[model samples]
Target: MSAPPLNPKAGLRAALLLLLCAVALVSITAAPAAGAGPGSPDSRRGDRTVVRTEQGLVRGLSHGSYTTFDGIPYAAPPTGPLRWRAPVPATAWQGVRDATRPAERCVQMPAPGASGVTGSEDCLYLDVTVPTAEPAAGKRPVMVWMHGGAFLGGSGSDYNAGRLSVQGDAVVVTVNYRLGIFGYFGHPGLGAAPPFGLADQQAALRWVRANAVRFGGDPRSVTLFGESAGALGICAHLTSPTAAGLFQRAVLQSGSCLTSFPRGALAPGTPAYEPFAPEAEVQMVGTRAARQLGCTEGGNEEVLACLRGRSTDRLATAQLMQSFNRPAFGNGLLPEAPARALASGRFHRLPVMLGTNHDEMRMFVGLSLAAFPIRTEGDYRARLTEAFGAAAPAVEARYRAADHPSPALAWAAVLTDRSFTCTTLAAGRTIAEHAPGLSLHGYEFDDPHAPVLAGLPANPDFPYGAAHGFEMPFLFTPFPTERPLDEAQRTLSDRMVAYWTAFARTGNPNSTDAPPWPALRMSSPHAPSVQSLAPEPGGIHPVDAYATHQCSFWDRLSR
Candidate 1:
């Protein structure tokens, strides 16, 4: 992770990851309506699309190829006394509410380089984008997106759904849920269920089920997808009993049920992180946070009330908010750790698309170079020792810096294999073993020259080749990058959008135009086939992801 903004490079990777995730979330925004008046050449041919939701009637804008309804409340705002609680039904409205603007993002800490805390407590809103070309009869498939910010920050409005909607010909929904302390804080006073942020996402799905047809979407064909933290949330939902029947398909990008980082994986000395925290641990953190904010004068209930009364600004600080980053498991929301659940064959039997980037750890490792420079082979070995302890020798021997351009790249490769690439492949193999009949597809986004989404100072030695979250730009258009996509990259982007949308349309991602994407074959468990997504010709081909990432080596060490 990059350091704070004051340090410029501080938490640069972490900050850039958050920003890239946010931009990827928003890149689905489609272009403006082609023409003006009804009689004009670019007119939508009919009146503005109006959908009568349970709360009220909403008027959305037409973008010629697609229509968008922004800032529609999925549930009542979780503000004031409602803070840290499961979302409640939104109140009905009187008039046709203009759904033109996106609602405020949920309360969140300032991302690195941000001026200050941004977003609001009243942020249980979602945005819907549908194809302008009317469906023949049946409703189009629905895709509900969860934005990523490591459970600390990010909003649904950051993504644009135009390309996904217009090109994929599906209904796309981006959601805003509670974040940071306001979203996942746990206390003894609260019940043993409901990670507020996850609950908020569940509530959004319920809203889509109830109102999808209003916007020409099929509730039964819903697909839940996200990147980084968002993907982790989807992983939780895959195993969440409350999430049953909410989504028919799922896609996990970068993060998964088994996705975790060793201590000092992102930045040297930073604590290791797991997506889920035990309820007791989270409650302990909450108690400490409450006391720090002077809310410990009374009983648990009283303390919660006091904390709820605190201003959003007061609770949403970088230091304070980061404390509440993990969602508590062992509750109604998550009965057990998702990885354990998957191991025991307890996850929902739904079609899944899971994968990671080639150089997943380079982004994080690159950012920490200045503060925790790995200048020599000795520096690299020291980091391995710090992270792996007894396994450091084996890890260092497996990844020699002489094989890489520099020590930093060698360290990044080690982290990538252990933390991301191998873990994701392991997850795929486990899923294949457990859910043999399910349509499971694995992919590796391998555009070595892929545009860097997160702004980092150029390094001569460390080239972030297909780094973490880099594949997002290809799926969603207009992501903030150093330069625009060339013809070949654009072709790759179109192919990705097709594969994604095709998967949403059906469980299978193969289309007539795109190359054949084979499902994960169980026969090759140790070398499971995965599609290599890249820009070059024949780039999108099957490769043994497990063998490529040397997952067998990590599996032995982990055992």
Candidate 2:
């Protein structure tokens, strides 16, 4: 089940593919009158049309003969006094809300390369894509997508569900939830709330449960799928009782429930898990943020009001200082660490599919390359030793410098395995042990032609490989048209859509025409079995991915 890299020549093509991946999360920012009219028909899709939803009637454009809906409010805007509170139901509209124009993205820090889009407090919105002419039939499976941006970045709007809806014939929903401090910060005044970002997501799912049937979806068969932070969110839902029954199946890409980057390991010598932050520590941070805003004790609603009045930029910037580690304890919704809950077999059992990219760390490492240059083997070994200590020597021995063309590539491989591959394997084993009856599928996306974003080195010789978030382009349309998918890659995209949508349709992802996907029985030492996805026609392979990556070491550390 090893996830090896493709030829470096393929990395150039992959760098060009980044634009399409960015398109997956692109959001249209024009706002209309409250309850605006129908949207203009998109010229690309044939036959313009409008559809009625529980919120209101929206007009959307047809692309490839599929209907699209944008800026649908699944929950009320978390503005004014409701900034950090749980999401409330969207107020009923007086007239048809134009679902055509996408709303401003949820208030968050500016993304890399994003321009002119000011963040706002009124950012709780969702977009929907459906493949049906009639909503009443409601036969299409519902797939909810969560974008991955380290829990600090990413938006539901970034992902375009068009291809998944049009080609795979499914109903796709993408949402924007609060991020950073605005979404996750918790304080004592809030009365034991944990990560409000996670709560906002649950609220979105609740909105879907209440109104999905109206939009050509089967609420009973809803499947939750997320990448990175979104995957972590799915893991939250799996454990939170409040999120139970909201989704029947889950697809976690490149992140897992056990994927916690410890803030401070309790005592200096304690094991990583032992240093897990408690509800008090999270509350302490929140209380401090509140105090900084001059919020006094008492007047709960008043304090919330004052905090809400603060500028969105200030809140986003302040939240970033903590460096995106906001999910914490105290909230009744998430009473315990997700990893702890999953380990004890206390989570809500459901069919699950989880995997990571081939070179997951390259997304981060490559971007930092210009700032943090790796000039020699000495530099590489120093970073490795700092991260893994005595174990660093063993890890370096396995992934030797000779194995890669450069020290940068070698370093990227180590981080990718530790942060992504190993953590995901731990999560899979926890699920398999806790819920043996549920269907579990594991995959490693190794497409080297995977997209890389702007600002990174574009040199064809610099190999980014199948880095993190590279799989996005194959699933969504690219923003910049420079690196559109070749025919073979498009076929790979089709297969991914088939696997994801098929999983949403039923517990299993197998179809008569699609490639056969084996259920995950065990990982690593148990067996050599994993699904491999690639752009080449015969590039797909199923082997022992966990064993190839030395996931056993991770499993031991996690234990």
Candidate 3:
């Protein structure tokens, strides 16, 4: 077979140049974030409070009893020649730094338009929320959260650490990293490289290791938790040597290492798998961008220099599309697929909590209606074949509309199984097989009152229906007040806080008041398996969610 494009220069240049410039404007639009004073009697535990970090003294506020410090630089901004290189430690700062407001988001393909927050290359920053009582014990468990946006878009600032900080009573840190081509494109000139996004995460973890003590946190007790792309990132860290010892626990919600959608890896029925764009392709994009700005040929270095000198906007478009900005292979930090690493038993050994929401793909399908429209059973079968091929017929037989309440329900079930449930279960089982001693726990979030985003259709009874990312608001602080949960949801949210906090405090999430959550047993002979979190008169219990989805067939296909 012909080699994968040695140079993805054309696609990279076309994709990156448009996004860089378009987001530049948004970066400039954000009002500078302000800092809150520490030890001030006014400090409410749940509000923001800027405390001194090893890097420098800073101010923040208290939300309830949790203190939040936002936009603390963990790495020197990747700019100029530093672009595409692994992150460097941030320079030490003098006196107190104002960390009351969030910093600029990392440069990324925007949310389908030029209207959202603009970003920049200088965006390796993190926010931390710690419990006020942390100092009494001299240390609290730390939970580092990675946000999810398909490896392209998301912000640490978008998440509220109130629940984890005040309720879980842990120090919660959220980070912003480079995204799209700006984060992952590789070139020969770049030399031996690390995945920039992973590098950014490591840098933040390093920062936590060096500085968590100052915030009354035990660095060694860090738990890395993330959803979606963030969860995938946690999986990458599980196998990255450079990330060893930085965290002791991990929580992956609704994303799996084995579920990567490889682009042009190999043709169906082909024996070989390769990347679509290799080193040469990446350099070509850089070269073209240089030429577009009137740089000389053979001036690869000069071209990159010129491109960097241009405004971020000149390179990125207004819509901030992401057709060509997915993860690249061969970076040292990632080296290969996460699934392969786990299968090889090369992953970090630690307590792991992995799970998925009930309906993961509804958000994707509903948002991208034109791409995943389902008008009939025939159409559904065709889509299933495209997703599962030889296994499609078997998958259909198990998830037929006759079994589902309706066609829409059937499609939702199929998407949920293929995209999330099966994938998460596979990850848990793999971890169990490869890392025997490590405790492995799994869960399913089944909240029917989850919030709907602006772009999605409003469902009076079941718009989001335990959909992907629906459980977030219940676990974190509610933003955009319009979407606040009702009394019933509030009660459920409180229960989630109890369960998650209990999990972070102890290896297990079991508590007298909290509902029972059983540990996943790969060799179990019982019917009840995988803990299910639902708001009901029956309360949380162990249910066979896998059986409902015909996971037996999926397991065969996966093998």
Task: Output the number of the TM-score-best candidate.
Answer: 1
Better of 2 and 3 by lDDT: 2
Query: What is every candidate's alpha-carbon RMSD to the true fold?
Result: 3.7, 7.6, 5.7
On residues 408-499, what C-alpha lDDT tens digit does candidate 1 reach at each position? 99999888888887787778778889888899998899999988764665787789899877886786665657777889999999998899
Cα lDDT, all candidates: 0.80, 0.68, 0.67
Total clashing residue pairs per candidate? Answer: 16, 22, 43
Range of the 10 consecutive residues with the lowest summed lDDT in candidate 1: 35-44
Q: Could you tell which candidate, 2 or 3, scores higher by TM-score?
A: 2
Q: Write one digit per residue (lDDT tens) for candidate 2, span 151-226.
A: 5556677666777886667789888887666776666667776566787788888878877876668889889999
Candidate 1 shows a clash count of 16
TM-score of candidate 2 versus the correct structure, residues matched by position: 0.85
- Mark the regions of model 3 whose C-alpha exceeds 4 Å error after superposition: 1-50, 113-117, 134-138, 261-296, 318-325, 370-372, 459-462, 525-527
| TM-score for each predicted model, relative to the true structure | 0.92, 0.85, 0.84
Q: Residue 410 in model 2: shift from native, Å?
A: 1.3
Model 3, 120-198: lDDT tens digits are 8788999888776644455788888888765566778877776668777788899998876667555455654666787
Model number with the top lDDT: 1
